[model samples]
Target: MEWDWNFVRQIMPVLVQGVKITILATLLGSILAAAVGLVIALGRRSDNRIVARSIGLIAEFIRGTPLLVQLYFIFYVLPDVGILLPPLLAGVIGLGVHYGTYTAEVYRAGIDNVPRGQWEAAKACNLSSRQTWTRIILPQAIPPMIPALANYFIGMFKETPLLSAITVLELMNQAKIVANSYYRYLEPITLVGAFFLAISLIAVVLMRWLEQRYGRIEP
Candidate 1:
């Protein structure tokens, strides 16, 4: 078939709307992931074995399961249990919880890499635990985490398509809808691919800039 400039122009608005949904999901999901992951990471590092072990088990469970299944469970099954959530909310929660496990590990690794002497120095100075973490450990640990966190944000962007499984109508979902309705998969699908690639390239460039900034801060 010949290239269809007219078709491309017609579908551009739909594609733009889909891109908006994708970005919204990614931003919201990343925020949730970051907040939840910090809690999980802290729990895993707790002095209490029960807290640590429980967080560890929960993180493992999340990481062990496929995100699609989690989305289905949240979107489809929860209503039966009286916790009905809207499709978009459920999608965000599912994606957030799924990626939170990964982000928890990233946080844990960063905290662990903080030199032991930092902790010792904090103790020697009689710093309270909160002071030690906020003033010393986190200051050192969080910079190293910037690059990994950026990667997770990018990963979340790609994973927004999984929300389509839950009927959230993100980028891929919109593309599929357009293709099915018009029986023209070529332009829509090609546009979707190009959109993802362009966004991903921009994300990578931003991430590299963040990595350099963080590197300088750490060094």
Candidate 2:
């Protein structure tokens, strides 16, 4: 089919809505994933072997399973057990949890990279564990981790298309609907690609800036 500017214009508004939702899901999921990853990392590093082992096992299970299956479980299976989340909420939870396992390793690495002397000095100063983490260790560890975490968020943004499996009206789902309605796949699909490519390029530029700012840590 010939490229139709008119059809493109007609579909822009719908696709724009989808784009907003796609971005929203990614942002929320990224926040949740960051928090969940930190928690998992800390839990796995606990002094108690049982807590560490349990958290390690859970993280490994999550990392081992496919994200799509997790989404299916959150959106489909949970409804049977009396939990029914909205599609967007379910998708956000699924994305956060599935990626959190991977990000936990990033957190662990960043934490480990902190000089052992820092911990020793904190204890020497009689700093509480909370004060040590907040005032010293985390402030140093988190900066370097930002670039890696941003990379995961970018991956999460790209994976937003998976949200469509749960009926979330993200870009890919909107494109599919438009294509099915007009019996024209080329325009909608192509538009979807263009939107994704454009956003991904923008994200790459931001990621580069983040890397320049926080890619390194001094011992």
Candidate 3:
């Protein structure tokens, strides 16, 4: 079939709308992931073995399961237990929780890289635990963590398509709707690819900026 500029034009608005949903989901999901991942990371580093082990087990369990299955459980299974989340909320939570596990590991690695002497010095100074972590450990540990966190942001963006499986009207879901309604897959699918590529390119640029900014300070 000949490429139809008219078809592309007609679907442009729909694709744009879908892109909005995609961005919103990514932003919300990333925020939640960052907050929860930090908690998990700190928990894994706790002096208490029980706290550390419990958080470690949770992070491992989430990483071990497929994100799609997690999404299904949140969207489909949880409702039976009286935890009903809207599709968008469920999608965001699934994405956040799945990637939060990965980011938690990233945080652990970053924290581990902090010089052992720093911790000793903090203790030598009689710094409280909170002061040691917030003032010394995190200030140093966080810069290296930025790149990993930014990478996860891009990964989460790509994975947003999975939300379509649960009927979240993200970019891919919107494309499916357009394709089904018009019985034309070419334009909508191609548009989806273009949208993803464009966003991925933007993300790459942003990641590089973050890397450069953080790398100089920490590396």
Each prediction's RMSD to truth: 2.2, 1.7, 1.9
lDDT of predicted model 3: 0.91
**What TM-score would every model get versus the actual structure?**
0.95, 0.97, 0.95
Residue range 147-219, candidate 2, lDDT tens digits = 8898889999999999999999999999999999999888899999999999999999998999898884332
> Which prediction has the highest lDDT against the true structure?
2
Error of 1 at 195 (Å): 0.4
> Model 2: how far is 20 from its true place, Å?
0.2
Residue 66 in candidate 2, Cα distance off native in Å: 0.7
**Model 1's lDDT to the true fold?**
0.89
Of the two candidates 2 and 3, the one with more favorable lDDT, higher being better, is: 2
Model 3 regions more than 4 Å off:
216-219
Candidate 1 weakest ten by summed lDDT: 210-219
Off by over 4 Å in 1: 216-219
Clash numbers, per candidate? 0, 0, 0
